[model samples]
Target: MQRLVLLMLFLFCFGSLHAQQTEPKKYLVYLSDKNNTPYTIQQPAQFLSEKAIARRQRQQISVTTRDLPVNPAYVQTIKGTGVEVWYTSRWFNAVVVRGTAEQLAQVNALSFVKNSRSLNRISSPSATNGTLAVKNSSGTSSEALNTMLAPGDYGLAYHQANMLGATELHDAGFHGEGMTIAVLDAGFPGVNTIPAFAHLYQNNQVIGTFDFVTRTENVYGANAHGTSVLSTMAAYLPGKMIGTAYKANYLLLRTEDAPTEHNIEEVNWLIAAEYADSAGADVINSSLGYTVFDAPSVSYSYEQMDGNTTIVARAADFAAATGILVVTSAGNDGNKTWKYISSPADADSVLTVGAVDSLGVVASFSSRGPTADGRIKPDVVALGANAYVLNSAGNLVKSNGTSFSGPIMAGFATTLWQANLSKTNYEIIQLIHRLGSKASAPDNTLGYGIPNYSRIVTGLPTLGAEEGVALVNPVTGNDLIILLADNWRIQLTELQIIDATGKLILKKMLQPDQERQTIDLQALALQKGVYLCRFISGNQIATIRFVKL
Candidate 1:
């Protein structure tokens, strides 16, 4: 009798479970048109902030229909089906809702409903406990004695900052003041409580915080990746550490979910980006990238890295179109099998950053790229390997990834932009590319290489006097030959080659009208490393860097 009762109980539970499984799942309903919208492009002030409007006015970008909100009547009709509307996307003219099959059938019957797709459901890894682990150190402790360094003292981070000429910008009083940056990343665990960020809080530089993953205002919980990333740009601990844009205002946004990887996170990012745009953010620094996902079926192949295909990439471009500069990481996938940059980084207008060491050499793990459309990726690079960052505990730590590099570059870019308010975003991006170390010879490894802010700000040296110059057979066992442009018989006053440390190793005083010159580096017994060749023709000077095998 007892065994029979147990069997009957199991049967009843199974029946109930099966019945519940038959219920409808949530779907993302894409709308066809926004014909019934109450808002209009002429009244952009309703949706866009004053700063946002000013940006558009300064850039001469006009408001369009896309800037208007989605049709409210269409949304109300969908909600009438007894389904709870979760979120709405103005960019896609869509809404996400949870409803039963019968309710969804009613929604599909509406003339405005274009199509609906089921939202992907995936289980979170137990190790993560539905939260991404904080990689940086975090906690409260007594302030160390060395916490009060001079304002100009960058401590261990000096090399990274100096590499991009950030120190020079800071010295020029362009420390990103009057500019606002939106940092979009996984999480920022202890930003409000950490002493390293005490200045940011004290000065009220942290203008706002939002968690898109949980749809809440509390972004101070999920993980510390953002905290570390932010430190690269905003940390102001004297003597101990200093960020690139220590004086800049910031908006902290949690867009990436550390515990789970899904297509939804991309949507979350898009939402956060729109928020940043509406909030009048001048620049956005996103260290997040997407290629693979927890659900293998939804993963993006290498070929799909084209700038226009991915949703996030399209959104990034849209963000740029709004007169906001978007800076993103190039991904740390160089040493892996899928050794190409991730989406959004592939977006043509976005400033994608790669990683390099203190010596200005490309990091082995920095993602390489020649976009699907054949454009050189990683518009620029910065010090990312063993990059200095502050943990939540208000302690300095060394971390490695393109994640840190992107913000470092972004911070510098902010200062640069602050210095030149008249320049458009497109013009600024082009200037940065032209100012990179390898701007003229960019490749897949380190596109355009590192940038020098001081050089860009002071005006790049003019090369008008000469047509072209090249180091024939750059890497070889024989003598290296310097080739000048055809019909260019300019007098060569002096030629010098220096080592990586700026030590002059070879010097030659050339005769007048010697257009072509040869330097036998083997006779100098130079070491195998990178060197810069400096050529002087009357008042014009040009420098070219080459590596020795």
Candidate 2:
């Protein structure tokens, strides 16, 4: 989805020159070092949670000075210059502050302050503001529902779940039983009040809330973008909707300002990611990205998307190093001029996701990329087109964007990790790449393509390829191209498309041709409606139903 890269935000008018110039400027004060910190790496518990420490131990990650909280003495000295210190980042060894020009001058002159980056948005309106919000999930125990619910209870959710092969994981009893996902977005406007999140509240699955944009504990206002994103993975209304990781605990963090595109948002995301790391999150779903910025604030160049350059990208890599698997959208500029994956998505450590329809056709707007440095971006694809998510009113709605797709894959990844708890974050990420569709023919359009969860546990592609109907149906293009499983093409095969009346619409006989075949639907002049596709290989047959939209 366009979680952080929508056009409306490009036209967003945060303030005029007079307002910006008159206001006290906010700055990201980079500290020279983390020397003489009160907390030691040996006793990380002073800053990091027990779970966080355990995760590091499990992954054989050695605690270092980077794991220590920012030096309190350094922060106090910066504040001595009269700038109000807003927040401190341990990883970056930096602090966010607001102050007058004179205050900034004094702080910059301090020997400990390496440099100060302006956090103020420029006057131009045609700059990046924030990622558009969408949904996936987080919640509590699935023990009750697992025992009481059936496959049909998932309703529309079943289709997308199957698309990600999450149903298989769910059925195997790994409903994110012991995982935590941190959702860093713009705001969670309706979460505290929305019915979709009521279950999470009742179960106390929502462990915490923080709005870095406001530096406040309240993340339940400002924008509803986060509400939709949370629902994709957290909502659990049986017979209506269900999240992929509905049983996983959640951390709602508002890191984007939503009204302006500024470098500070990247800093905000960095701090939130750090919070996720310290909070012991097993996964981080940041449906946020960055590219252009307003004037007076320099925008990122295409070359800067090399993953190691941007502040947020660096943080994403470090988060993964700390054992938190990060999942982020590949941006939604594919149809536009700035058509490349955004920062953090470019980071090598995170799983960058792109959007695709049920037909597995790349959504025209899902960003594309071989990263600026030529690394394959959007490490995978997921069903982002018309992804089923919950709105504030508890309505099961279709939301689109890499925004929704990122969470779909994020929650799925979390559940998969729950099933393979012994795997490190790096191993888990590598597993997805390995099981993804045809790693040998990986492309930037869909990265390695949709992940193959069946192979994750079974060590083989699901020969029951009928299950792919959800991912290959509701044809929208003029032609149909089917990618057959190896077994499907092992013998003479007969393929038939039948209308609802059981009348044969089209039939074809193949002499074990290669896996992919094209059927020109335009030539058939087929009407839009439900249809059944039947394929017969040897004595085995399978009939799969699909939709039009």
**Model number with the top TM-score:** 2
Each model's TM-score, in the order given? Answer: 0.75, 0.77
lDDT of 1 by residue, 451-529 (tens): 8864552233322235355676446764767766643345544566756543456777755555567777778887776
* lDDT tens digits by residue: candidate 2, 375-463: 99889998888988877666788988999999989889998787556568887788788767756678999898888565552222222
Clashing pairs for model 1 are 138-392, 138-393, 139-393
Residue 164, candidate 1: how far off, in angstroms?
0.4
**Candidate 1, lDDT over the whole model:** 0.77
Q: Give the 10-residue window scoring lowest on summed lDDT in candidate 1.
A: 131-140
The numbered model that scores best in lDDT is 2
lDDT for each of the candidates?
A: 0.77, 0.78
Candidate 1 regions exceeding 4 Å error are 1-26, 99-105, 122-152, 457-549
